[model samples]
Target: METSASSPSVSDTPPGHTRIFLVVVDDTEEMRAALAFACRRARATDGRVALLRVIEPSELQHFAFIGKIVEHETREQAEQMLQRMAAEVNRRSGHLPSLHVRQGKPVDELLALVREDPGISVLVLAAGRGKEGPGPLVTACGAGLGSRLRIPVTIVPAGMSEEEIERLA
Candidate 1:
């Protein structure tokens, strides 16, 4: 696991305690909605947004050299994606978010981050619109995993409009 901040820490709250909204970053279209919701909520509540991008283990492990190259490239791509999203989060919330990159199963990494970071007060995800159902993270959380988490999980609907999210948040 690797973690870094996009800019100078934006999590410094007026009060000693900070409410960190954790959003898992991915390539899915629904991910935008989750990010938007989290940013708006963070802005409204004087909280901070944290993004976690989990890179699945490469299948090229059989070729040690190739695996190492693949791992480096994958991590680079994840960092780039996080940088782009961090700009959006900063624009919306007036604070740059802390970025995290991990290699493992998405659910496992997410759970571990939450357990390790007590400042993470909420886990926000967006439900998928595909026939495959509400995506793996949402499905996993709904299947009792959410109950095990110390923080509350917020699942945003994929089709929700920006205006609706702004109003709700």
Candidate 2:
């Protein structure tokens, strides 16, 4: 990739190159497929991909009164999960991809990473569940993340089949 002093955004192309992708990963199946799709798209477009995983703050402390009823993964556990997910993505891509792990709110980390790295031209995210549950209802939190980010974001809905996902790839 080439960097120019005049531009605010970083270009993924190395003068003559054409494409690049940035995918944000989470512990969901949908997230996995989205990353795959992004990789596939990048491959088709002759671009490179960056796989990032953000660890959200623990929700356990808020509901400590419930006492073990709500089982949440630790940050380390989440990191492990992210590694597995990254491995899966790498397998499909047939290359060792760039991986990033950060601690903070998901949206905040994602946006900050994008701002810090100009190579990331697109953001791929899994569509989160709504209060009613299932099938892509608009959640304020999810919507806020998409709206706040400077780059374009593609939200992969939950429960998508591999075949369905491959089409996007």
Candidate 3:
């Protein structure tokens, strides 16, 4: 995959200049909108978007082989989804989003990635418009955890149009 100097792929970056805006990507339109917002912002900042999806770990101790197959399939699905998102980013923002798949709770994994990667500058998420309120990860991260985290979390409201996101970018 060819990379440009201004906007690099979301997954990889040049040494000493890897500013990242991590986006929590899920199977939701709200998540997609958040990703779009992150891509625009990253492009504006000469950074990249790390598109991350977390899958729940399988519980198949009764059948270890089946559990392994389930795990593999889950990872594949996540990859396919991320690839589609990357393509959208390329089409809309002229940048390829970096893809990541982790098997664990979203909040824990997201926070761990932030701790592990110093290049990550912010966590981007979409506020769920559901009556129950925002998703668990967004609520947890936006709660008291935000103060403890090294990076800030940017919450894009649900249904924000592409034009508004571009303006913010």
- C-alpha lDDT score of every prediction, in listed order: 0.87, 0.58, 0.73
Better of 2 and 3 by lDDT: 3
Superposition TM-score, candidate 3 onto the true structure: 0.84
Q: Candidate 3's residue-wise lDDT over 1-169, tens digit each?
A: 1112233443355534756778877876678778888888877876667777888788985899999999888888887877777788777656666666787877777777777667677888888888868777677865777876898789998778878888883
Q: Which is the leading candidate under TM-score?
A: 1
> What TM-score does candidate 1 get on C-alpha atoms?
0.93
Q: What CA RMSD would candidate 2 show?
A: 7.6
Candidate 1: tens digits of C-alpha lDDT, residues 1-169? 7768746442343323777888999988899899999999999988889999999999998899999999999999999999988999999998889899999999889888878776788899999999989999999987988988988999998699889999983
Q: Candidate 2's error at 102, in angstroms? A: 1.0
Worst 10 residues of 3 by lDDT: 1-10
Residue 84 displacement (Å), model 1: 0.8
Q: How many residue pairs clash in all the candidates, one count each?
A: 0, 0, 2
Strongest candidate by lDDT: 1
* Native-to-model Cα distance after best TM-score fit, residue 47 in candidate 3, in Å: 1.9
